[model samples]
Target: MAWNEPGGGNNKGPKDPWGGGDQGPPDLDEALQKLQEKLGGIFGGKSGSGGSGGGGGPAFSAPLLGVLALGAAVVWGLMGFYQIDEQERAVVLRFGKYLETVQPGLQWNPPLVDEVIKVNTTKVRAASFREIMLTQDENIVEVNMSVQYVINDPDKFVLKVRDPEISLQHAAQSALRHVVGDTGMDLVLTEGRAKIASDVQTRLQEYLNLYETGILVSKVNVDDSKPPSQVQAAFDDVIKAREDEERVKNEAQAYANGIVPEARGGAQRQIEEANAYKEQVIANAQGEADRFSKLLAEYRKAPEVTRERLYLDAIQNVYGNTSKVMVDVEGGNNMMYLPLDKLAEQSQQRAVRAPSLDSNTLREITNMVTEQLRRDAAASGSTSRRGGR
Candidate 1:
């Protein structure tokens, strides 16, 4: 049953499947030689030759070695297929020279021929720069700022500069220093922060363009700006003083706005009143002059009669305004005068003191006024009779 079992044969080694004469699990050398010759027949190489030239051990399996090498090559090629993220771009270089850029996706390249560099084109990157800078006002301040950017051209980013990010950092610092240096310290430290940041952004973009850094600046922010620690208190005081100054100026302007209009209105009112007064005075003078001219023309026709009429009219006007009445009788030697204003004043005083008047006192005063009037009338009649004679 067994090839090497001993009992049934007479001077025989073992049963031989290939008609071998002897066997104890066939000779190890002869089996290897047969395998080498068979391999030579298949590949057309001298299979008579072993793996290590002239070796007698079983030839190393050629087909198995070829299978292992093929597996290794497949793995290496698979390793070249890498994935690029949505925010990134893949710049491909072949044989150390520019080839092409790839979009975001799974991509492949020849394992040894191509090199890929992934650049983030949509990710916003930030660089912070801080430096002690001199301001246009000749004061020193610490300016801390940040710049946000993105890679716009991945090829230029990788090939144009040896280290684009480091160059960006330097450019940011230079731009910040230049902007701060051109701005006043008060502005840099306070109200002008946004302006300084904008100026820095513009300058940084220019620098990046000049250097072909392929960076697009998105925004620039002024993080912190301040005077040195030794002068911070003084700067704070100065800031407060400036605020107070601004407040005072605003208040003064408001006051001027309020008072100026009112003053102008008052002045306009005064001017209008003066103009009315001037018009009224001129009209009155013109009317008086015209009346005088008319009266002069009438007087030229009859001199004596007009003179007498004018004298009586003057006396009438004067007497109408007076508190007392006076009569000059042509035939009488004395003038008769009635102090009616004084009598009225006395009556008013009495009425104010007593609130009532006595009827007997009013009767006695009336009798005296009547007697004086009768005597003046008799004298006027006597004068008239003598003139008729």
Candidate 2:
């Protein structure tokens, strides 16, 4: 029936699974022999028989040991292999001490002997700060700043500082406070924010370098700079007033820009017109002077004839514009009345209508009138004398 059941089947006391009939306890030596044989087979070594005469029990063969050692070495080497991404760097430490920094890609180092710490070198990490700081003018201002940084040196980042990000945060706060303290409140709350941000970045980088944090401050942004909430309304009113002042100044400047140009243009035009008038008057005066010089030459040649001609020309000019004429007869009781105005008008009208009636014809008619006047004077038995040489 059962393998361990007594009497009926075998006539033996009980069959021991270990060896034969004696079941006091399984033999320790026999158990050790079985375990050795299985292990030897796995390692490609000969197994010893389960007997005392089986030489030195389970001795290791040289070839089997060599294969085992090689397998162990291969497993250790595989454990040392690691891969790093493009944006990452690895810092290797040997025996818990700083060893070397490794670049990205497949890398291998002795496992359990050298420790590898990976850091993302190209990643841009940010730390923001908002704190109340006193300005140089002893005014309170709320400064909100954000610092962006990256791990430039993986070795220093891992070994030099226990916590690089925390160090960077502290450094940023110190730098921001220092910069804000050195600046006036007006600048911190207005256009001066950009300059303050720049200064903070520079100062923060210096601190990181000083601490060997291996962090590069890429950018610093100063967001909203404002007065505290207790005085926000007052600050807004001030800002509005400042803006109004600026707007008024701009309007005045624009008006001046428009009016000044127009005024200058008008002045320039007047100056040019006056110069033209001056040139015209000067040219006319010069021409009159030349005519007078020529007339003077003619007068010097014949004094009486030139003087009589001048007097006749003056009389013709005077009579040309008059509508009525009254001549005093020499040694006569009544004045002589001549319809000279009507005759001059008729002559002027005939000259305008006829092309043949020119200035020469009008001059001949004037000579005929002068001869008639002389006859009339001769009839009066007197000659007319002119005054004012």
Residue 348 lDDT (model 1): 93
For residues 1-389, write the lDDT of model 2, one tens digit per residue.
Answer: 56567745444676566655645556676667777777877867687554652543545798777888999999999999999999998988899998888887899999999999899989898888999989999999998888888899888888889998899889999999999999998899889988998899899899999999999999999988999999999999999999999999999999999999999999999999999999999999999999999999999999899999999999999888777788887656658778866887887797689776667877998899889987987776543333211
lDDT (10s digit) by residue, model 1, range 285-337: 99999988988988999889889989999988998899988766656566778
Candidate 1 stretches with Cα past 4 Å from truth are 1-77, 83-86, 302-305, 324-389
lDDT value for candidate 2? 0.86
Relative to the true structure, candidate 1 has a C-alpha RMSD (angstroms) of 10.3
Worst 10 residues of 2 by lDDT: 380-389
Error of 2 at 255 (Å): 1.8
Best-performing candidate as measured by TM-score? 1
Judge candidate 1 at residue 319 and give its lDDT.
Answer: 85
Report residue 269 deviation for candidate 1 (angstroms): 2.9
Q: State the TM-score for model 2.
A: 0.65
> Candidates' TM-scores?
0.68, 0.65
Question: What are the candidates' C-alpha RMSDs?
Answer: 10.3, 9.4
